[model samples]
Target: MPKIFSLFFLFVLLISCDEDVLPKPKAYLSLEYPKKSYKKLPLKRPYTFNVLKNTTIIDDKNNWLKIKYPTLKASIDITYRPIQNNMKELLTEAEKLVFKHAVKAEQIIPKDFVNTKNRVFGSLYEITGNAASQLQFHVTDSTHHFIKGSLYFYAKPNYDSILPAVAYIKSDILHLIETLEWKKSI
Candidate 1:
């Protein structure tokens, strides 16, 4: 009976000596995506740009493209529109599409891009916060071709959780813009 009592006392002492229970500080996920490699997506589209090596093309019809990154649960949607007599309207709609996210976005940043030699001038938007899309861009020759691309993740829109992927994919987008040239421009 003495031995049993001693064992009980020892167990109680050990359990009670634990450190105070404090809540853990918040930590975002650490996602490491592969370094980007430029590969002309094997599509007969009018423009060609270096994209990530592992990007899987989902659709390449009528100049519309869907690049999928299943591992990252993200996709880039490319929409091509012929500039009818309405470049103004197209720009308005693209800007509207991006601004619509302002309801859920902390802020929307616009960065202008121009490549006069290639005649590829455009604007890229980085929508911060819990928006459905983290990045979007609209590029055109102002007379013939207009393309809008947006990046969306399949998972919930938590920018903090998927920031690593956003930064990595953003580099690829910049590469594409830098290297983009319309067949007509050629």
Candidate 2:
């Protein structure tokens, strides 16, 4: 009886002396984006602008285009609408297109852009949160050309998971806006 009691005590002491177990540390996804080199898009339209070297421009109908990043599964859909005394209506439709994401967006930030030399003016919307589109913009000469652009991920919308891609593509959009020049002839 005394030997059994001593054996149990020794086993308990040895087990208790071992280090405590801990849960594994949480891991996060790390995404690396490439550096962007901007070059002017070769197109004959009322306006022209630069695009990221990483993108492939799929020829769309009329003056419209889709700037696609296949590796990232994302694309910027661009639509060109002629402004024939209907700038107000066109602008309203652009606004509505962005505001429609308000239900899922945490916030919609509008950055107004204007370049007198290029005669390009527009509002860029940065939609934060798990929205379908992370960015949208509309550029126009206020008389002749209207360009509406929106960025969409091919995958399901998850802001945190796709943020790196969004940030990388957003810079390209800004470059496009900055370099936009109205040729005023199709």
Candidate 3:
């Protein structure tokens, strides 16, 4: 009986060994984002810009706004400042906010935007890796209006997982910057 059992075990082992063990390839989620449609935000702040029609705008006091993407679990926090001869200081503050995530960011790539016709000038900072904020930007008219915006996710910072959403929103941000206009008063 023991010999028969050993033969059965050996037969099973030989059968299993016929196929080489192979590692399964890693998989990622296949995300499908909606086709974008944009319109001007209906708020009477010091500034105006186009936002994704799918987003919900939450207007806070003092010209601060939260552009929420509930489906995507993200939001762009916007803070508006009236430049009172403090352009240098404001630029420093915006850079500080971007670099604060440097400890967690693998890289920070900055792209500058200058639209002299629209009187808009700014820099967009893209933060790679597991940083808290994936994107940050600051735009100004150099004399009267300045705004700083940051992109944040509601979940834990996993750069790889959130990259698609980041990309989608980044285009929306670019549109906003392109359409950005400042008013003399709100």
Candidate 4:
């Protein structure tokens, strides 16, 4: 009986000689987004752009718009201001709103867009980190029309978790900028 017990203990010890157990790294949600299809924003406004077919446009006073993505629990809030020789002020205000997230943002990257034929010149600012807004942009004809947009998620900012969704919407925004047009000079 003593010999059998020693053999059993040795077998158990050998079997258990393994690497230390480690906790798993965090797992992120595997999100699948719909393919991109866009149509004219079905609303009459001073400015117009192509919006993702999946979104809902909530028109507000002063020609403001909330382009809502219900499935993603996010929206792009857009505000339009007609330029009255106040381009400098409008540009400053837009930059201010983008930089406001700097307190929590790891970085702010600005990309300038210029389409002389469309008279659309703008800057898209991508904020990286757990900021309230992940993206902010401003486009203008530089004389007649000015529009600013900010992307927001309904949930508290979780940079890692929301990064994929942000990238998806960022593409849509780039498309919007590409297709933006003014109905007429104000």
What's the TM-score of each model vs. the native? 0.83, 0.84, 0.86, 0.87
Off by over 4 Å in 4: 1-28
Please give the range of 10 consecutive residues that has the lowest summed lDDT in model 4: 177-186
Residue-level lDDT of model 1, residues 1-186, one tens digit each, is 999999999999999989887899998666667766778867777777777888898766678998888899899999988898989999999999999999999999999998999999999999999999999999998889999999999988998888888988888888888988888642
- Best TM-score goes to which candidate? 4
Candidate 1 off by > 4 Å: 1-29
Candidates sorted by lDDT, descending order?
A: 3, 4, 2, 1
Q: Write the per-residue lDDT of candidate 4 for residues 82-184, one digit (tens) a residue.
A: 9998999999999999999999999999999999999999999999999999999999999889999999999999999899999999999999999999988
Q: Report the lDDT tens digits of candidate 2 across residue range 81-104.
A: 998899999999999999999999
Candidate 4 — number of clashing residue pairs?
A: 0
- The local distance difference test score of each candidate is 0.89, 0.91, 0.96, 0.95
Residue 177 lDDT, candidate 4, scale 0-100: 98
Please state the error at residue 100 of candidate 2 in Å: 0.7
Clashing pairs in 4: none
Model 3: lowest-lDDT 10 consecutive positions: 177-186
Best by lDDT: 3
Residue lDDT tens for model 3, 1-186: 999999999999998899888999998788998899999989998889999999999989989999999999999999998899899999999999999999999999999999999899999999999999999999999999999999999999999889999999999999999999988777
